[model samples]
Target: MKRPDTRAASVGVIDIGSNSVRLVVYQAMERSLVTVFNEKALCGLGREVQTTGLLAADAVDKALTALKRFRALCKVQKVGEVHAIATAACRDASNGPDFIAKAEKICGASIQILTGPEEARYSALGVISGIHKPDGIVGDLGGGSLELIDVRGHQVRSGVTLPLGSLALQDLAEKSLKKAQRIASEALTDLPQLLAGENRTFYAVGGTWRALARIHIIQSGYPLGVMHGYAIPAAEALAFVRRLRRLVAADMLADIEAIAEARRPLLAYAALVLEHVIRIARPTTVVFSTFGVREGLLYSKLPDTERAKDGLLCAAQDLNELLSRSAQHARELIDWTDRLFRVVHIRETEEERRLRHAACLLSDIGWRMHPDHRGEQTYGIVLNGNFGSISHEGRIFVALSVFFRYEGLRDETAPPPLTQQLSQAAIDRARVLGTAFRVAHLISAARPGVLPATHFRTQDRKLMLIFEHQMVDLVADRVGGRFKQLARLVGRSGSIVRS
Candidate 1:
């Protein structure tokens, strides 16, 4: 007997952009797609397109070579399907069609050349797929063009694209920072998409913006280094980018190697574009997104039902299925906690409820680890997991709850530094949920069909855990003490009842 070849189920995307040629192979085409392989080559296909009006011969050769390598890598991975798309440089350069024709033959795949509007729409969809209930403008700056669109929730309004990408801007201004500023300002003047973005989020999507955000993260000493959903106040962001404009590329790279070497010189051009957009758009916050055209394209192909699923919960459910003692036990825990919260009058917002559900699914993931290290390990896993639709603050809350479940909610059981990102109210709530986990896990022993037989009730200012007759023997001193701790967190006494 032989094992099945599961690698054949993977899907891949090859993105031909102005500045970079990249390939990403995802685990599946489902709602919660995971990247199994990712690689990129900085080809600079649009480096001379702005001035020469043609793709540079060397740049074209570099892109085609990268594509050939990507195709072979996809074959080695046994990728079931591969979709190739080209943007900006390919569509604008006069020789772009000829280049695409050659590249297609080399990769053995038909390439879709996306127009500016199509690029804008896909970028907006990518933002919508990653951010929960996003209401903002999505601006994708590539090496040759910038796409701007307005999005609220799932709806994407009309969008506009401009020739303000870093490489293109540099070529247009002949490497003059002052001229780049003037060109960006002139190109973005009085755009309605930007006008509609006042006081809302400006979702920055592109490699350059991600590199810029990485710099911000390294400098701020932020606990979580995840780039997706990193946010900054518009005023503060303006000040930072303005400071960059005054410095040379060497100064910008001083003591900072977090950004790519190829991307360093373009930083000022990117900053200039951002500065002008912020000034005109008057957005309140700038959010950086790792998801962009590729993610958006995948999202566009999904059915509405799949698109409606909660990404965080979906990802968590996958983890629970893979690692839990019993996936059914996790589901029962969700319901049991639901009853407990209601009985104890623990109010939760809709978002908080979802976070709690995800935490329950992930609570037992560290059971396979050593007892001494389970808390720390699980905390780090959830804190840095490749999850979306949850903010950094929400991540801290969920992680802390699971941490308390293993480590025990005692004063001496100090939490990690990331907990500081959450509010005091949220921390208290996590402690309460974690204490509930402590009691529940003990009663059921990580098995299903035990929690449903038990329920919670309140009388005379005392929270009571009532167990059926068959489960009476499972109760003990430790259970009572843990229940008491949970009750105390909510300002109530604790008791256990057998019925």
Candidate 2:
């Protein structure tokens, strides 16, 4: 079967959950999920379901209005197809079918009301798609329920759904924190055995968990504000949750910019569930996942071959092609650097090799920026860019390398927390890569040809740059200086020879 052309298409997805309804339009590319447009309305359909066992008339009206608006937006954006999915609230409410019929008419798309188990499976798939080789239990806490599943890499094992969602628990516990904890504890009694293992990581999904993670990121002064791959030691996460559990509404809202005004009311309930899960699972760490049901649905549409492509490489290549001065020049840079690293007896771990490849592809992305600001601009882009299958450490390595490449060696712009996470060896490696890129860019001028004619070698503890005899005049003083700088970084004197 021919694989789907996900890269060439734009699609819209509508996620109707208990607490909110969201419409996201994505420009799906080979290795990246890029959100072009997104909007959400908090309709609290789940709260309505918990209260009266039926979708509320007011909530239905609000949701229908949102659906119509979403349909118009998708039309204006020229989205080829739209996928509308509803979870817990719509699936469990007595009047759900009636609402779905109306929603379909307004949105002009079939609304998929996922069963509990189906929802669990999709949530697990989302984790697999976003994380690299994820092996642990994934807990997706939505407004109406929580779904827990064991995932070994990309495979999803059996999962269970419980009525322990923040909004639902808030209603069940009658707004008491103690009651909410007790209810959460009771709901999770059977999950501990399911998660029993050594050094397992728990992947937390859903908006509420993301909100909690955002707060932690701000409070801890983490350099990377992105939450998709944020991780915390289990012990620390437990303590944080415990503190959140004891906080009153006023305290939850105090001086915390991470928590939005609308999400404040759900923090305590989110905390209760997180605390119990951490205590029961005893995971070595808790990792946050920004992709959940919506991402899962998109992943499900991909062909297996596309699904198997390295996400980091795909995203890197996409950005490189879009921003680089010459894509061929970037490829030449990769090959040129590979040969140099081999000649210098430098070794890279598999992960390091992948990061190096990505860095090379992205080396010239800042050429369009003002010359004075290129290095700093490139550093920020790599630091905050949407490249998946890369960890926090890897992000720092790539960003710092690019920063040094553009900005030269400077400590003035380095953030203490970011530097603290890197080892001396990692820092040294980044410097070497950065210096190497600086030399390559000068020699090729980020153009496409003659890279293969130049060679690098090490002899008598001196780094030698061998240029073809015909290209001798092409090597400028600035290029020679960068080459010597790279040589110095590797503890060697620099020499230039014409072969």
Candidate 3:
């Protein structure tokens, strides 16, 4: 196994799935995978694989064409290495080996045909890479097969592959929904542990599942459009799946503008499969994971030390380094805020602390945007950013905090839908964190210099900001006013002193 080139300018991965062939170019960062370019061609390689046991001729042609273009794309993007992996369709198809040979020639890279368990393990690793402390069963439903693996933290348990994928089941059951459901349930019956992941999370992978999640997000008017950590209660998810199962093609196309027209055909089968899984597994939540086999391949190449880093923090740091005025200042902000929060006696749980750290690292990402649009831009960026390891609520908290930091406390432009999902306590804490950031920025101006030495202390039931005598010139009415606002939110009167 070749170690990932940490200094590689870019790395490309082509995922040849049952239904689609995608080429993703990622700027391989120190601790994060940032997508630079991604395009998918729906080749439907598994369209007739269940019955014919061979890759469709037209599908193979399309995939080959796509591969040629993707190879060119890698060259144009200056990608140092390109990894190509073919999943269920290629593994199950009789002509798969021939296709792989031709694909290797076209793409100028060897195509690795992943076995069922290998696919399951990679999908699980994808979940582990994107989620913090994931302890549940990961289900990756592709067009040809479904891969289920139990994952706890970074460890992967034995997984099973079922012939119950949407496309395969559609053909297996002759497009009968009831028969598909029965087949899925029966296929999963032997895996009692997988079916009995009660109250745990069921992480959904694969393009079909992501499309279903997108439909749900649009139908429900979800504020955040990102799907990496989109989670819904098991009951609501099951209900939504059931509703999707009953929806006609016209209705589905009309209701979900997020789903592409080509994907609409598989919606019902996807829903039917999901509904059966939900009924048996009874997970407390259904989480949509954007990471899958492709991401897992990248993750697997990383050194163990790099892989052990926190996913959310890695993303935050990457963003800071890429976009902020000074990544060092962001690190300083984290440390400075740590002292501020401790001095203010702000109680933060471990999760809250991690979110706060991420927010601090991301605080200055919007500096280059126009002043008027910075707040809105930051809000959208943080909310929809490719961050992993944080829940939807954590995303909301971080986005809102950064939004307030740039937009000020009195701005009425906050999106209500997102804010409403957060608790009052969470909202207040975010406000405090944001206000702290605002004050910090005012004093430091997002520069790489040392911040004015200051200490926060409680005196006579009031918040006192004591500045060093040498740093008194850095304090101003604007800085004091922001501090006072944070003080108010924390239910304390505020005063500033140069000592």
Candidate 4:
């Protein structure tokens, strides 16, 4: 992404959520958000609908005024484009279309209303595009709804919008924030089963979750503000969630007055929802995403290579470096995996390939876990550790590669639901890449850049093994009586020495 050129050009994005209205200006040349103008005016668009099946007039006026001002900002900043979107709020409103048409007339931009699934997909893209570390599930908790996305490698596998939101919980149950916590718990019952045993990363999106993380950081004294890629250990997250639950919303009055006196009643409910989801998902760690649906939709329109500039994978590496320490050479790990990828004649989209390279960087990170159990630890980290900013699809590949690094994943079956979204081609690549990774680990022997330069070459539909002299000698020694078994792995047997 070209950041703001010497002269900045702002790109405006207006996100109309059930809770608030925001207009953001992106200095693309600088790859930075130059200005963020937003207000949490408590539109109550969903709240009024729970009673009268319509958006409250007051909420509409507040939101429209924000939009009008956003239009003025675009004019003043000379933004090239204004992309606006409404989630859960307008999408669920009976008269949302009317609002959209009216808003467009006043603001000179269409108010794109997103269905739950649409919101989930775009949020995943936005979060992923901003960071790298290819695999994970992203849950964006908006005011009126919850969007869930399953990302595998470079593609979005599946998404569903469930009728769950912080503010909406208050309105739907007619309960106090404390009582709403139970309601939030009841709502997340099926999630654990839906997410378990897959070995994917879980990420949280939306303002409420981000705020909770910020508060946790402040209260616990976690350092750093650009924590979009920070990892909160699952255990710590659980404890934090529990602490939030024990407090009476009334008791929290003094602590969070900054959230606004009006929203105090509802803010606790949002906190409860965040805690409940964290419990159900059993994510090893949770990461906060600053960008959500709007950023994602904008990212989807970017060219493929430019999209790679999204820092999810890079963010993952940063977090991993901070959270994980490796005794092995990171470069050696990457070089070995790179060689494996070449040997398998790996076929991947440019994004998937880059993400897979990330997988290589930490394949041996688990060496710190214990030599006897490095595979298990590495596998565990791959499954539960946060990779930060990776596309939902990239997350899947990361997990899959981790599975291959160990001995257990071959027998693993895909969750029945993923079949609809993960292509056959992707599954095949997963298997190929996984096997190549196994071979690379064997050659790497815990020392990077030392792997025997062996490659699989094809001639006349038969796979031939070409090996360096040193590797040929090692293979001959390791395979004494099991040469046949080794040969079967690569298709042809008597390892021939070349060069």
Candidate 5:
């Protein structure tokens, strides 16, 4: 029997959390998952659990309704598999089992009720999979509980969960802000894992914290609006959260109507908890992660070898295959650039090499766009793409490199203001790499086997491009000019050699 084509198959995950019920469908169950459909409803399942010890009747109803719709959506999207998970609210509420039974009937999938530690582990894994070599404490703030875990590289240490989640804390404090602050402060005073975060990064996860980050982004006039991997210094974040605690949620409505109405009330509590965490953790920076248990669930299913792959390169290669004139040519371009850089005596760190390789894969993605807009279009895609394992600064570098590949490297071809986030060294590297792309694409016309026949060499401050005997006819004045441009960026004059 012929094996079924898994390439076209889709996977869906339904997460029933304390504050919301969300369903996310991915294009496929691969290392680089691309979200095709996502929908969520604010169910607030854990809002009353602190006081009543049972899932609220209304919240359960809303969650069941959302699950029913999600099941139908999965069917509509032809999702090959569906995995459902329930978090803190469902695990602690007395009536959670009954609700889970109804939800399972609606979603047509078994519900895995995650214990506190399990939730923390998945949160850590999500960060590990999304961010490159993450060294920090992972803080997952849901409506019912806050899970704090320590993660370094691929290793995750044991973590502790506190009942300091926004909804639960609000309920426990009887809606008093002062009381909630006291509760949050007391609960976080003794966590060793949080203490271990000193001078390292603190990865923040969950919707409420994300909403807070969004507000921070708008208020601060950050050039790039993308939220994932947005970093803020610890002291600065502490000051921002303190200021948030002072503002009325209603006052923020006029400024940030983009925030969900349901999340507005909980902002203060979220801010209160975050302030306490920053104070106790003493972390140097707080980085926001959009990946959570949902991405973690998908990540956990990958084989050991697949789990070890770089998410950024995987995503880049996928895009190149789908969008480029030739994916094989893109791979060849990597080797060609490798040769060029080596011959030019250009040094690169391991991270820089991977990023340059990713840029090479993405260099030609804008070919189909109109000639006048390719630069802007491709820049936006790379800067805001859903790919992970890259920081905001790194995203700007790759985006600028691709931008310059299409638009000339002249000062007049200015990128968006967000490019300012990159350091001078990174900008120079991007320009140098972008200049190489400009020459490489012009020489090969984005086809394979051509770049392989050509080589680069240096002769005492002069860079030379050599064409094989059979391919010597491919050389011309245009190629010569671009080669000179690339060489000039590296402080060397260029000449072409026929061999």
Candidate 6:
């Protein structure tokens, strides 16, 4: 989906939580939504606001700056309508109205402070619409508050909001687990009755909760990255919480990196709360989801009639809307490479084709430290991407192919093995297939229709290159001699000629 146009209608959701504020831009056409922009800032506005009863000066400043930037981005992105929501911070603050007024002045968008119950409802609605329609309890544990709603038999019913978010509890009590447990036990006193229904599942939402889930997965070497419907058995989830509870926040994590940074300190608090809630709710299972209130806000406001459209639920439609999940374009790149394979005499079976497509979808995903390190980053992202729905061979193919992209580019003086996880022959094919992707980039030179031209037949031990002459030189230079070697390996050709 393209960015929202100034002439067309758009919706922006600004979520003001205790720890973060986010501005999400969605393009709404005929009641269907395609999120075009997503930007978030960590404010921790209620970091110590709960105890002081005043928003911290720095947190307020950070929030104002983020809102101002969000406002400008909305205007630049052509967003037309905006719905800004403030959760525990504003709701709990006596000066929240003043904060909202100031934020509105800075952002040029009205800010609505949500009541605790209202927050729970919106969060529960978000989970139901964005994820499963199961009978369970939706637990959205935030930095400053805990919102738990009961979903029994497809009906979203009663829930309670407690002043027990990680930061909020830390401020109110001490940073220790004993202090956090006290807050959680008080907050979860209502859970037993709420989860009294038959065979309920526990759905954990919020940044800290999801981070814990990822940590568990990463630490245990779980095979997948798509966490939308990922599950952890009640026993494992509870046990993980126990381990976290035993350690201090400082002791639990040496250093949080990547997406897990901000949530590291909050993990112990989140875990303490989760253990109490689970004990009371007595949930048989736990499902962790990356989507939350932002997703719910988008779903809730859609014209009711269009909410039932099912075609958009297909693979690309959902994944395309997310930056990380933007696989359609990458998939198309794979398709183009498939056509190039025939022209270049690269022989791959149906299985190879499938795995290559998976690799392509993940080629650009990296460790997020640096774009220049994309190849090095792709190595890690591929393993993290999971592609679990595919076969074991498919997973190995993606991991190996992605590693091929960065192995040589990495700054390591001594190079590592060609295929990090595959055999020598598999590693060789990945080199050839990865070359096709690099060639496509060069041929396109970042332009459309720059993709490889039709029919690349080998002649006289040379790859008779066959793109529009305009791109031939570009492909040759950009590919940096990989094309010749690839052609030779594929069909014993040395030189490549352009058509």
Clashes of each: 0, 0, 0, 29, 0, 2
- Per-residue lDDT for 391-436 in model 2, tens only? 8888889888887788776557554247668999999999999989
Report the alpha-carbon TM-score of model 1 versus the true structure: 0.97
- Hey, what RMSD does candidate 4 come out at? 12.6
TM-score of each model, paired residue for residue: 0.97, 0.93, 0.93, 0.60, 0.97, 0.62
Per-residue lDDT tens digits for candidate 1, residues 1-499, read 9988654378899999999999999888878778889999999999999899999889888998898899889989888899999999999999999999999999899999999999999999988888888899999999999999999999999999999999999999999988888899889989999999999999999999888888778767776888888998999899988877777555747556687788888999999999999999999999998888998999899899999988889889988988999999999999999999999888999999999999999989999999999999999999888867777888889999999999986678777778878889998999899989999999999999999999899997999999999999998999998899899998899998999
What are the per-residue Cα lDDT tens digits for candidate 6 across 1-499? 9886455687788888899898888765433345678877878888777778878888888999999888888888777788888999887777777888899899776777888788888777666665534568888988889888876433678877888888898888766677767766876676554457325788888988887877777777866555656678787888888886676444756464634466567777888888887777777888875556766666666566654443113222333324342345465676676766776666777657666665665654442447566665565555444222333334556666666554432246233333444666776787777666655544553344455343455666566556666655654453546666556556666445566
Best candidate, lDDT:
5
Residue-level lDDT tens digits of model 5 in 1-499: 9987748689999999999999999999888889999999999999999999999999998999888899999988889999999998999999999999988888878999999999999999999888989999999999999999999998989898888888999999999999998888888987898889999999999999999899999889898888889999999999999898888544654445868989888999999999999999999999999988888878989999999999999999999999999999999999998998888788999889999999999999999999999999999999999988999988998999999899987778666657778888988899899889988899889989899999988889999999999899989999999999989988999999999
lDDT of 4 by residue, 72-155 (tens): 878877887778888886877789888888888888877788877788889877666655544677888877888877765566
Please list all clashing residue pairs in model 5, or write none if there are none: none
Across 160-208, the per-residue lDDT of candidate 3 in tens digits comes to 8888777888878887777787887778765765765788999999888
Better model by TM-score, 1 or 2?
1
Model 1 per-residue lDDT at 235 = 97
Give the C-alpha lDDT of model 2. Answer: 0.84
- Candidate 2 lands at a TM-score of 0.93
Give per-residue lDDT, candidate 6, residue 120. Answer: 84
What candidate 3 gets wrong by more than 4 Å, as runs, is 1-7, 249-257, 411-417
Each model's lDDT comes to 0.91, 0.84, 0.86, 0.63, 0.91, 0.67
Error of 3 at 315 (Å): 1.5
RMSD of each: 1.5, 3.5, 3.5, 12.6, 1.8, 9.5
